[model samples]
Target: MSCQRGQYVTAAVVTAGAISGAYYAYRWYQENATKIPEQWTQVGTLKDIYAYPVKSCGPVIMNKAELSILGLKDGWLRDRFLMVVDEKNNFVTARAYPEMLLVHPSVKSSVLTLKHADMEPVHVNLAEVVTNQCAKTARVWGVEVPVFDCGHETSEWISRILDKSSNNFRLVYYASHGARTLRAGTSKIYRFTKNDTGALPDEVPFNLVNQASVDDLNTRLKETQVTPRNFRPNFVMKGGKAYDEDNWKFVKIGDNVFEIIKPCFRCILTTIDPETGVRNVNADPLETLKTYRQSTEPAARRSAGSSPRMGVQMSLRSAPGGLVKLDDPIYVA
Candidate 1:
């Protein structure tokens, strides 16, 4: 009976070890395995392109744009090129000033025109701003970024539109003072050179949002159905399943190839209505997304607890800098 009990104990220990080993193997696969499937079908076309010259301000819709290594090169390579800063040079956005949504921007040739309903139209010469290389460092998300002060005249114009006192708000252009590098926590899938840089964008140089994903969220909302304007995507893709962009590793739009960096983690800005410049009291879509869209991968998760993600941030890979036109055929690569 003693020998039989000893054998039973040995069997239990082996079984426990096997179970633990299997659990760890599964966890490893979940973190390291490729999310891409064996066959990724072409499920979308580039339906829209938006360039936000100023962060948190209105966007300029385009039919065709040059895709450079940095980002969409539209009008002096001005996607998020200009940002509104406070007296201390801290970045401002619609999150703090909801009225920023009402500011509309349009570009024609060398001119960038800004219009607000309550204020007169403000125009700035894009070439002139680019030529003025006077560098000033400002804070975006608390990181000190080098920028070109757009002169006191342009700063006063923006302050007037924002309804702030003089010297309280200023508009600064990203002057590329030094090599702008990616943050430390980026995934290891892509490479960035010393010359690679970004403007005042929150993270990646470009953001791609699936039309189906927004449609899916609208269906789940209680009262307000949001549009692509609310999400502020550089490329809006059509003909994909809801949230299909999450698995895409790379895609070619027209002549430019883009690599997906990671899924875009959303914030309270989504709950704000772009048209009305008002935020939803209940946080409709974000509350609903947290229930289902949170990432399971360890690298994708921002922290122990963070908001769920919806779209994917992309990086430009094409070297020659080609034109990505409206309705460009999008193919998974």
Candidate 2:
């Protein structure tokens, strides 16, 4: 009986020690998870900054901009804060109507101006849209988002430019106070918190492209050369080896810090020319990327299928309101 008691006590002590060790290990990881490493590698330099005030439309290039949780911002211009929707409130993009890519959106003072080569420039009073327009819900990528209609005048303007016969389209601005719930499949892959959903962006708030990578891809093209604009990245970096961004978990530019969330999977959109609004006949770059850039992990392969990995999607890790500027050194940890 005495021998049995000794064995029982020894087993109990062993189990207790294991539990204590696990507790301390978890505590250590929790404390260190968010801490930036002391040593970081200088990966590249910020070459350009882009803010797409309207989704699938032209970008507003800036030398310096404030980083917000939603995305890059100036006084009245925020990234992907305005989107075009059909009469049914379904989101529209350049994918269906390639001419949408040619619409240039710019903001000055309290007005938003939209210019297209084929049509006259139209202006919308942004302040009036916010103060007077009624809030309504619009569907985008299977998510419902709160938005304000910019009235029939702007709607008619956009509709005439895209499709002259049908007055079935409308211009909508994001209601700044509301958030859209991410689709279950997207949330599974991105692991975004409630606060991470930003306006009408396709996914995350920030997208970064390495210029070296685009150059490398151009080398593989037989008849076509692609540029960073094809990828629609918010931040463009240079001076790094091609595809070095694949390994970066976190990056810092100026005083702004961003956590790399996932590899941006390329799609048919990359095949479209941002300048001409025409798709490549051969789909050379995307086809070329398929040969080499497919994700190796089985789970990632299942999630992304045949899409090739290009830039990295990111979220602001440091507090918002930090400024990122042209030529800022990009440090990766």
Backbone clashes (count) for model 1: 0
TM-score of model 1 relative to the true fold? 0.81
Which has the greatest TM-score? 2
Which stretches in model 1 have alpha-carbon errors above 4 Å? 1-40, 177-179, 184-197, 302-304
> What lDDT does candidate 1 reach at residue 279?
90
The positional error of residue 52 in candidate 2, measured at the CA in angstroms, is: 0.6
TM-score of each: 0.81, 0.88
lDDT per residue as tens, model 1, 5-75: 11101334445534643454354334333333334357789999998888999888888887644467664
User: lDDT per residue, candidate 2, 1-333, as tens digits?
Assistant: 121111001333445534643454354334334556567889889999999999999999999998766788886788999999997999999888888889999999758999998878999977667656667889889788878888888788889878894478999988743236776677365556565567798888899999999999988899998889999999999999999998888889976778787899988888889999999999867899999999998888999999999999887777656899999999999
Clash pairs detected, candidate 1? none
